[model samples]
Target: MTVRTDLLIVGAGPTGLTLGIDLARRGVDALVVERADGLFPGSRGKGIQPRTMEVFDDLGVLDAIRAAGGSYPVGMIWQDGKRVGEHRMFDPAEVTEDSPHAEPWMVPQWRTQEILFGRLEELGGQVAFGREVVGLTQDEDGVTVRFPAGESVRARYVVAADGGRSAVRRAVGIGMTGETVDPSPMLVADVRIAGLDRDNWHIFPPHGEGDGFLAVCPLAGTEDFQVVARFPEGASVDVSLEGIRKVVAARSHLAPDDVTEVRWASGFRPRAALADRFRDGRVFLAGDAAHVHSPAGGQGLNTSVQDAYNLGWKLGAVLRDGAAAGLLDTYEEERRHVAADMLGLSTSVHRGEVRRGEATCQLGLGYRESSLTKETRATPGAVRAGDRAPDGNLDGVRLFDAFRGPHWTVVAVGVEAPVVPEAVRVVRGRALESYGCGVFLVRPDGYVGWAGDQTAGGLGYLGRFGGR
Candidate 1:
């Protein structure tokens, strides 16, 4: 049997599900497929950055995400069975009107996926489990994908979100150039343990003499503690329950019996890589499929989610709104650069060359160099073209509330703005520090696409995106 859809998404992880929800809400027909029978059952990506929380607000899942997670706990260093001192994990950040979410939230990757999956279903999207894309072929018109069972699918566009070892990426002959970030192997698991307080992330520094660093962090909103341990170079990491208990007993003050239950466990060597290209013909690569990051600084999953957010609206515009197909080319141009930079940041964090501070939170990241951005003003203010639209009150209306949905926003900030197409929303208000004095054209993904001091070249800018 052959199924057909306007967009086919392979690998229903956070990236695919996020794109699915965005497309579904835009009235774009998209299907997400997974090879596994269910969502991934691990607590690998447990840290959700503040920028992603803002994205969740726009996607209509902020309430559920906030309910399912809590703020990260402070780190507690241990020495010889005694608590030495408390170590702050992230830099102190105060929540303000411009930046609402200031800290990273703690939610296991499994739970995050479940929440996104539920949202996808609520948006009238579908995910077909037990389906794997074994083969693929794309032409000028569309792409045809074949499964192991001989069933096939035809889609106007195919996106590969199938993780680090992506079959679709391999089939399409894209190359990933990268290097291993760490020489040692690491074990991560979610287990129920006793004799450890849940107030802080317990840390046991390396004992030198061949022993590696160990840390046990309490998974907020759940009863499990995520255990992390490093092994010497060229050593194998045991993931069994007994092995995890032994490691905890050997590294910390607790005994083996302290680990009462073990839910899941896995091990991996940290590595970072980026694909040569994000798109090929009618196919595109997303998430780990396009760029692989070290599980440090909590960037992989958050970056992946943003990738889908960036591409979803462009796909919707080209496929449903009769926009020029050239708009699709910007996806690779904008996202590939961000992915490359993020890969470098992840590598730095893994090697201890940088701290997980403002950069890891991802609030400062933007598409200032994107070709889609137009800054016609000679002296742009604090906020310029391609900057993330800050949240604030304008004209007695909340900015985020006005920008929430599948519509472009033409904001007049302390200036007379040009009139945009009726399909776009117009908000007139005095300029706050969140946005500077000018006319700002906000994209669906919450970035200022174009900024200017007057109406000059306003319509010309909008015309490129099917706006006027």
Candidate 2:
């Protein structure tokens, strides 16, 4: 069967599903296609950062996400079968009004995908499973893709959320440049253990020369623990149930019988790579397809979800809101830089050059350097153009609630807002501590697109995105 959609998402992971939800809520005709018939089942990429939490809140999935996950547990270091001490994975930070989610949350990647898939279905969206793209052709107007199972699709825009080895990316001929963060191959598996306590993430350091460390983190909201172990470069590693048992027995004091079962297993080499470009013709790359990160800082899935969040609105604007197509160009300009920065951060965390701290949370990321950001005010306040619009309660209204939905927002903080079209949401309040006293325009993605001392220049920024 031949299907038609406004946006064709080539993956069913967090990236494609998030984009599906966003575009579906925006009233865009979109479809998510997955090569696999069911959601990915594993605990890989289990860390959801603070910024990603905010994004989920806006997407109406926060309640489900919070209910499905828990905060990261403290690390428990062990040596010679004895508990040495307790270790903190992240520095403590108080959750403030402006930044509500202060630390990373631990949810299995499979659970995250399940929650997102549910949200997508709740939005009346459809995902085509077992539909693998074998060919892609693009013209001046739209993209046409074909699969081997007698299925084809025509989409106005095609998003390659397919993953690191993206079929669509390779079909489109986009090049990637990157380096191997670690030469040592790693084995990650979800296993059931009998003797381990779920209260802490158990860590077992290398005992002898050429040995690698092992970490068993209890999966929040689940009975399983994710086991991660590294082997010397080129050493043979096993992922079988008995193999995992042997590793646990050798690395820790636990006997092979302690490993109850192995649910899923996989082996990989850590890599950090980014696509040479984010956009080509009518095709765009998002998530792991665009930027592959070492699983060090838990940025891979979070960054990919944010990429969909960033592009969803722009595509909706141009397709449904009558905005100029030039708005689409900024997607690459803004997201590419962010992806590059995140690639470096992930590599740093992998090498132990940087700790998983404030940067890894991703709440401070912004697009100040993008051409779309306009800081007209001569003197900037606490908030500036291209900064994340901090959340706060002011004048009996929640700023995030005002900025919710698929609409732009013009916030008048101790200033008068200019006359705006009904398409733009108007929020007025007293001086906010987080945003300060200025006229701020928040994009559909929740970042400040424009800021000024008064309403005179605020309207201009809205016009660029078809808000005025």
Candidate 3:
């Protein structure tokens, strides 16, 4: 059986699902396929960063996610059974007042997906489970996709979100170039504790004969916590409850019997790798399909969500109104930098004794190299025209209305302001001092297109992105 659609997305994970929802909301029909029968129920990738929260807010799913999960204000780093340092997450609510997004929230990946999948359904899109894309062929006009169920789909564009071992990427002959970390098998378990400490994330650095470290983080709405033990090379210990109990007892004074119940457990290795290219003609890749890195910073899920968000609006614009195909190229140019930077940072976090900082994981990224960036001469750390525009209020208007589509937002401050046409949503406020003023153009995906003083070629900057 052969089907047709405007876009065919391979994989039904968070990235693919979010892409489908974004396209559907824009009235651009998309078909998503997944090999799994249903959502993966696991404790994988539980931290949702601020940028991701803003993306979710734009998609109108933030409220659902918040309702599903709560927040933790602090993340701690420990060494030798003592607290070394602590970093508090920038409050998403406070940050969003001046940002495109409010603040980052902590939630399980499954809960985040549940809300996103619900939103996709509300947008009249559905995932075709138990279907996998086995092969793909793309030309200038479109892509022809073959599935394992003896089915085929012809789409104007194809997205590979099938994960690190992506079949679509292989079929298209894209090389995923990078180094894999040595297989240091780590034991991960989710369990309930009767008398163990539960105040904050617990870290036990290598002590005595143990090889690596043990980390404990709280699981919201439950009395249990997620425990991660990085075993030293050649360390022999089973991942069973008795094994965990013995290890905990050996490292800390905690007893094995203190662990009342074990909810889940697994052992896996982490790696850092990225695709050499993100696009090949009509086919593109997103999420883990393009890059894979250590979970040390909890950035895998957040980065993947951002990847889909960036591609969603661009692809929707192209499919619906014939927006420039050049926009699609920016995905690779922009996200690959992010992935490379992530790989570097994760490598550091993995080896060094220092705990990763939230700023390194969240705030420091900027898409200045993109053609969409306007103010080129700005210094580093300065809010340039093309960076991720910070969130703040303009007059009384909020920057992003998650329930509705984002508009070309113009932030005009100062006594002498350029007259922006009615086609743009202009907000006049003094809060622009922290972010910027003159004129700021925001892409539909909530990225800054251009920002500069009113006299800094605001008109030219606006014209670049189709603002009249």
Candidate 4:
């Protein structure tokens, strides 16, 4: 069988699925293929940061996530059943009221995928289950993707979101570069615990006879909690219910028999790795295919979802509106930095540093490489160059009323600027300082383009991407 699509997404995980939904919502036809026959089970990433919430809100799925299992504001840090520090997600002092959704939410990756999958289906896209990409070939025009079930797909672009062990990435010959940190062989189990607290995540360090550290995270939609235990270096242990109980007993004061029902369990060697390149011709990589890091900050899934959000609109713009080919290259330039930043942040967290503040991995990411980025003499941090632009109200306009849906916005501050093109929506405002100075060209994915004074070189900024 053969099929054709504007974009062929190689994996049906959160990254690929979110990209599929975004494309479908934009009336772009996308086909997503996955090897898994059903929704993924297990508790991988549980914390959804505020930035991701903003992306979901833009996609019109935040309400559903809020209705489902939502995030708690307060999280606790513990050591040997003793509380060390408490972290609250929203700091009104650090964050401005201009940002609509400023708090992070907590939910299992499974639930998040379920919500995203449902949204994808609602957007008129479905995942091809039990189909895996066995081979990939790309040319100047398009990509030819072959699946395990004697199926071939032709697509203008292909995204590799096929997890850490990405076959698509390997097929494209992109080498993953980075060293495995600690290789902390750990057992991640979702089970019912008798006396475990269900409110906050509990981290129990090695006390005495235990060979590992115990991490307890509350599971949404159930009284049970997810437990992660890192075994001693080079220690091998079974991942079954019995093995989990033995480890739990050795680490905590709880008895081995206290653990009753074991829902799911798996062992993993936590590693920090990033792809040397994010794109090669018509082939692109996002999510775990691009990078893999320890789950310390719960950033794995959120980062992947954001990658799709960042890349989807660019791909859609190019496919639908004749955006220049160079526009697509910015995906790697913008996202690779994010992947490297995530690798560093996760490494720090794994080394036992308490990261207190808006996670740099989430907040510090920006797209300064876009041709739309304006030249500015402003110092760093004074202007939010390459960061996600802040959302604010325009005097009489209501909050989120501007730039609510998927559309590029050009906010011209000074009157000396060139006439705003009809292709871009112009908002005349004196509050350019809120977003930044000069003419702010915002991409459809909510990243900043040019923010400081415009150039007299015939709007050469537009010419960079063949824009009007």
Candidate 5:
């Protein structure tokens, strides 16, 4: 049988689910297919950076995410079965009107996917489990994906969110350029344990020159702890229950039996890689398929989610809002640069050259150099075009509330509002300190697409993307 859709998203992990949610909310017909029968069952990629929290807020899942997770605890160092010292997980940042969510929130990867999946289903999105893309052929008009069961899916566009070892990426023949961030293989597991207090993240440093460090962090909102242990270079990691218990007993004061339940386990060597290209004809790579991080600095999942956020609106505009096809080209033009920067940041954090502070939070990320951005103001204010539209109050209305949904917004801050397309939402009021005195055209994804001192420049910029 042949199924058809405007967009076919491979892998129902955070990226595909997020793209599905965004497209569904825009009334765009998109399908998300995954090889696995269900969501990823692990606590990996648990750090939800403050910027991602804003993305979740726009997607309408922030409340659920905040409810399901808690703040990261202080790190408690252990040596010779005794407490040594304390370590802060992230650099402190104050919550401001513009940046409300200042720190990283901890929720297991599985729960985040579940919440996204739930939101997708609620928005009338569809996910076909067990549909693996074994082969793919793309024409000028659309791409046809083949499955092992002889089923075929034809889509105007296809996205690969399948992961670092992406089948669709291979089918498209995209090459990944990367380096091993660390030679030591690491083991990660989600386990239920006794004898450990949940107040702090437990850390056990390497005992000797040849030994490796181990860390056990309480997975918030669940009775489980995420254990990460490193092995000496060239040493194989053991992921079995007994293997984990042995490590825990040797590294910490807890006994082997203290690890009462081993929920899941996996092993990997820390590596950083990025696809040579984000797009290949009608097929585009996203998430781990596009760029694989070291899992340090908590950038992989957050960057992946933002990829979906970046591509979703462009897809919706082309398919639903009569946008020019050239608008889609900006996806690679914009995201490729961001991915390269994030890859560097992840590697830096893994090597301890960069701290997990303002940089890792991702609020500073933007597309100032993108072709889509129009900065007509000669002397720009603190907030400029291509910067993220910060959350704040304008005339007693929360800016985020006005920016919510699948529509563009015009924030006229102490300026005459331009005549925009009837579809665009406009808010006129005194200049917000975060926005400054200008006419800001906010994209549906919450970035300032165009900013100018007057209305003429802003109106023309919008006309190119159906904003007129």
Candidate 6:
């Protein structure tokens, strides 16, 4: 018998799980399905940027995420089997009331997924593992997704978060346009090392012309050290324990037996690609399915998570909030451009043209050009419509506290608050430096949707999203 869900998410990774949690809290009837028998077991995409930290905060998993991870360690470079120099993994940023998380946090991807899954469960959400989509058919009403065992699911909307080799993306005939960021194949593995200190991310530069760099980073909150080694162009990477041992021995002072255990291992050639379109009818592409990025800048996962954050609210608006169906179109219009920009940033980091600092943190990403954004101020403040709303205190109310739920928020600073629907939360105060004299309508995703010197057009902007 076929089951029915309002939304079907095709992946159990961070992207799909994040979307599931967001929708679940919003009381949306959503199901997440994974082709694998269990969650992805790897330490890939371990860095959680500052922007994602805010998203996690709103999702009610920030404290758990913070407990499960630690700040990134400084890089320790070695040469001639001895300590050589030091390098900072990320340029530092000061933590302030507005931006709390200043740097990236290190949490193995597996642990991160587990935390997200647990939160989803707490919100009364469920995921069906081994439910691979073998076939898909969609019309104006909804999409019917088929599985190999003759089971099927009918969803009003389908989200493809199934990773780079997305079968759903293929079935939908979406093309990915991209280039190989690097010709050299790299091997990444999570292993227990007997002779390594967990204090620093060990780096060993290539000693010869044909050799490549090797980095072993300690996965915070765990004993596993992620081993990443680059190989020459056109060389095959071995992902087995023996292969990893060989690479470790040949590149560093560590002996072959130093790598005690290989928990997970994988190999890939870095490439940057973007889906020609993020949506086709009722199905949407997200995460690796939408845009594949090099892991250099730690952007792939963060960008993917934000994609869900961006799409989740819009889906809730259309499916539950009685908003206009046309609002869904802004998902592609807003996210595709952000994805494109992030793709370029990751590629640049891979090429060493950029550093893992502010750009990598992702706090600066916004939708200034989005059609959904309305800036009616004669002179916009530092924070404008389409910019992220900064966290601060306004008349004894914390801004983030007000913006936490799956609802719109109005930050009226040094201005009289306007009448708004009960669905919208309002915070009024004397003066928030981040936000000058203006009324700001913050979206569910924490970005300012409308900012005005006066409350003239703010209500009309809110009406578009069923806030009236």
Model 5: residue 109 alpha-carbon error in angstroms: 0.4
Q: What would you estimate as the lDDT of candidate 3? A: 0.73
lDDT of 2 by residue, 233-340 (tens): 998779999999999999998999999999999999999999999999999999999999999999999999999999999999888888899999999999999999
Q: Which ten residues in a row have the lowest lDDT in candidate 1?
A: 459-468
- Writing each residue's lDDT as its tens digit, candidate 3 over 1-468 gives 889999999988888998988888878879988888987666677777777777777788877877776666365666544578874433224433555433445676666777788899988999999887777787878899987767899999999999999999999999987775646778778877765455667766676664777777777645668888878776654778888887776665467787777777777777889898999998899999998978766778888888888888778656765557787888888888887887777666776644545554465577877866776334422466666666655676655541236346665555255676565666666745566445566677666677666546776766544452
Determine the backbone clash count of candidate 5: 0
Model 4's TM-score against the true structure? 0.89
TM-score of 3: 0.86
Q: Candidate 5: lDDT of 446?
A: 91
Winner by TM-score between candidate 6 and candidate 2: 6
Best by lDDT: 6
> What is the C-alpha lDDT profile of model 1 across 1-468, one tens digit per residue?
999899999998999999999999999999999999999998899989999998999999999899998999889999999988998888899999989999999999999999999999999999999998889998898999998999999999999999999999999999999999999999999999999999999999977789999999999889999999999999999899889989999999999999999899999999999999999998999999999999989999999999999999999999888889888899999999899999999999988899888999999889999999999898998888999999889978888998889888988888887877888888888768767788989999999999988877877877766772
User: Which parts of model 1 have CA positions greater than 4 angstroms off?
Assistant: none
Which prediction has more favorable TM-score, 1 or 5?
5
- How many times do residue backbones clash in model 2? 0
Of 1 and 4, the candidate ahead on lDDT is 1
| Whole-model lDDT values for every prediction | 0.91, 0.92, 0.73, 0.76, 0.93, 0.95
Clashes of 1: 0
lDDT tens per residue, model 5, 427-456: 989868877898999999999999988888
| Descending-lDDT candidate ranking | 6, 5, 2, 1, 4, 3
Model 4 residue runs over 4 Å out of place are 72-95, 101-103, 354-356, 369-372, 376-381, 414-423, 452-468
Higher-TM-score candidate of 4 and 5: 5
